[model samples]
Target: MGPKVIAFFLPRPPNYPMPFVDVGDDILLDILALCDVYTVIAVSAIDKRLHALTQTKQLWLSLIQDSTFRHVLELRPPNNLELQLHSTRELVDLIKRAVIGPPPWWPGGPSSSRTPSYTIAFNTGLEIIHDYRLLPGARYMALRGASAVGKDLVMYEVWTGRCVWGIAKRTLTRFAIDVVPGGTTARVLLALPTAYVGGGYHLYVEEVDFITGTSSEVFRLGFATRLKSLIAIVGEFLLYSLPSSDAEEKQVLVNWRKSTYVVLNYGTETNSSAILIPGYIVASHPDTSPPYQQLFTVTELDAFAPHWQPLTTISLSGQLFPSTIPITTQERLEYKGRPLGEFMRTHVRLSITPSAVYRGASTVMVYVNEFPKPRPTPTLTAQMGAFFRGRRQPEESARAALLTYWLKPPGQACGLRLVSAQLATPSFNTSPLTPPRAVLEHSGSSFTVSYYQ
Candidate 1:
C-alpha cells in the first residue's frame, strides 16, 4: 500500500563547546599554518593548549618557509642562521613584529609627543638649495643647491654626521633626486643636465649606488622647458611633471628599466599632486575607486564638493597589500582652529604630504598644513602702508604644521586618528636659503627624520 519509506537520519553538525581545540594536533597545525604571523601570535595568547600548539617547531618552521617571511629575512638578513634555526620561536616573533608593525597608540594620548629627537643645522654660507631628499633606510640625506657657477649635490650620513658623498659643483641647473626603497643596495635616481639639443635642454637620469657612490647614465629626455618636479619613483616607474603654457599639465611616467614612458593628463581645473609612499602611488582624482581612500592632492572646490572634507583613511594600494583604514582628522585640527563656523569665514588650505608609511605598521608620519588664505604675502606696497600707519607689518601667518596619524584596525570604527600636531615654529620657517621642511629617512628599526630650519 504505502511505499516503504525509510526514515533517513541526517548527521547533525557538531556543536562542541571547543570544536577547534577538539581537533587533532595535526589538523590544528595545518589550520594554524595557513594563518598569518600576527594571527598565530594572537591565537597563541588565548590559552595554554593553543599556546603550546603554536609554539611547536613544526609550526614556526612552516612560517619561516613562507614567501613573505622569507623576503623580510632576505631584506633584513639575520645575523646567524644557526641561531635562528635553534630558536624558531624567537625567529617567528621577530618576523611577526616586522610584518605586524608597532602596536597601535591612542590619539591625543600620553604617548604623543611633538618634540624632535635632535636637530642638525645646515651650513649657512652655501648657495640657495632648490630641492632635497632623504634616502630610504635613513642612512643618507641628499641636498641639491643652486649656485652661479653650477649646481652642487651633497650626501651625508645621519648618525655619524659625515659627508659620505659629494658632487663637486657642476653647471647642471635643473636637478631632482629619489632613493629606491628597501635593502642596503639603495639606488639614487639623479636627474642631471646634459648637452643642449633641439632648441631645448637635454636631461639624463643617472643611477647612483648609495653604498659605493658609483653612477651611470640610465636614459635621457629632451625638454623644451625646465623639469618642474620629480613627483615620485616606484619600482621601475619614475613619475615627474613639467611646466606648460596651459595650467593643465601632463604627468609623465618613465620606466628607467624598460626605457618606455606614459603620459597621464588630468583635466583642467584639477590641481593634482602625487607622492610615492612605502607601497602605493597616491593621487588626487574625483573618480578614485573607494570614496574613503585618502586624497593627497590639494584641491579648490566648493563646500559641497566631495573633496571638501578630509577623509578618515590613510588609504594604500600596491602590488602586494591593498587596503584602507579610517584615520582621525579632527584631533589634528584642534590647535589649528575650530571646524564649524571657521570654514565659512576663511578658506582653509589642507595639504597632506606623507613622508613614510612603514611596512607592517599602522603609524604614518605626514606633514599637514591647514591655514587660512589668501596667505598674506608681504608686498612692498603693504610694507609702505604699514610704515605710514606706524603699525607692525602683519606677522606672517604660520601655514605649515607636522602631524602624525595612527590608523586603527577594522570594526573598531576608529579611523585615522591624529596623535600629534606641532606648528612649524619661526625657527622652522622657510626662507630664501633654507626652506622650512622635514625629510624622513628609514633607519633599520626607526626613522632618522631631518627638518630644515
Candidate 2:
C-alpha cells in the first residue's frame, strides 16, 4: 500500500495484440442507428465481436419500433400466454377436430350440384350472384344479416322506406323495408336482392368495388330475397330457427359438405360462451379464374369447443362487424378468457346517427356475401328511452341533471346526452353529490339507456 505499485496491472501484457481500437460506445450506438433492424439482430448473434451490439438496450429498443417486426414477434412467440395448448403438426387440423368434432363435411369437398345451392347463415348474411341469364328467369330466395362483406362488387338490397322502381339498364323494382332482430324495426339500408323473378326487377341499396366484405347476422343462415314477397320467402324458410327463450346454443346440422357453417343464438347464449363463425364463408363460388376462397378459424387451447374435429380452424376475427367490434375469437386470440364462438350473439343493436333524426325507415342490415334478405313487411317500431344520473328533477320534471353514458360507434363521438332539468323549490334540499340516474351503454348498434326517476 505504501509503494503505490499497480501490482494488478499486467505491465501492458508484453504485446497483447495491437492497441484496443476505440469504436467508442457512442460511435457504436450511432452505427447501430444506421443499420437496419435485420442487420442488427443478425450481427448481435455472432461471437463477442458482434454479439456485444445487442448488449446495448437502445439497439433492442429501436428494433421494437418497426411495426412489421413487432407484429411478427407478437404472432411467433406469443408471449404472456396464460393458457397453454398442445402443438400439432397441422394447426388447422387441430382446430377442425376441436370445434366440428364429428366429420361434418366430406373430406373430398362439396358434392356436385345441379342448380347450384349455397349455404346460408343467420348471423353472417349470405350473398348469391346470378348472371344476367338467371336474373329475370330463375326463382330463388334472398337472405342476409346487417351488412355485406367482400367488395369490388356492388350488392344492393331494397329501398328501406316506400316502394320505388327505376330503369337500371332495364326495369328494376325494390321491396320496401328491412329484416332486423326487433320484429318490425328497420335499418337505414335494406338488403338488396340479387335474384328477380316473374319479371326483370332490381333494388339499389349500395355500390362497391373488390368484394372483400363480411359481416355477422343472428341466424345460422342469412339469405336475401329482392322479391316483394318477403313474408312468403321467410315464412316458407325453415333452414334457420326462430328466436326462442327455451332453446340451447348448439351446432345445428346443416351443410353436407366438408365445409360446414355453424350457428349460435343470442337469446340462448350463457356466460363465458361465444359464437365463433369463420370469415369468408360462402356457399356459391364465382365462375372465374382461380377461385379465391377462404374459410378458416383458429381456436385457443382453453377454447370452449365441446368438439374438436371437423370444425377446428375457424376464424371470425376478420369478418365485418367482428373486425370492428370486440367479438369472440375461436381460441381467444388475445387470451381474454373466451373463444370467438363463445363471444358473438344473434340479435345485435347498433347506435347510429343520420345527422338528423331516425325519422324515415333506416336500416342496419347485415349480410353474408351480401345483405340479409329483408322482411317484406316491417311491423315493429324502434324502442327508445332515456335517463340521467345527475339531473335534478323539478316539480313538473327536474332542476339540473347529468347523464352518464358509455357511447358506441356511429354516434360515439356525439356528446348528446338525454337530460331534463328545471329547478327544485328553495325549500327542498338537494345536494350536488346526488349522481344522475341516467346510465347508457352501447349494445350492438343501439344505445341502451337505463335509469330511475
CA shift of 169, model 2, Å: 18
lDDT of 1: 0.46
| Per-model TM-score on C-alpha atoms | 0.44, 0.19
Instruction: Find the 10 residues in a row with the least total lDDT in model 2.
Output: 132-141
Tens-digit per-residue lDDT, 262-370, candidate 1: 4444322233444443333334322224222223221111111222112221111211111121111223133455321122122122333322212232444444333
Q: Could you give candidate 2's per-residue lDDT for residues 29-105 as a string of tens digits?
A: 67775554545656667668666655555554443333333221111111223112323223323323322222322
Superposed by TM-score, candidate 1 places the C-alpha of residue 420 at a distance from the truth, in angstroms, of 15
Q: For every candidate structure, what is the RMSD over all alpha carbons to the true structure, in angstroms?
A: 13.0, 25.4
For each candidate, the alpha-carbon lDDT, in order, equals 0.46, 0.26
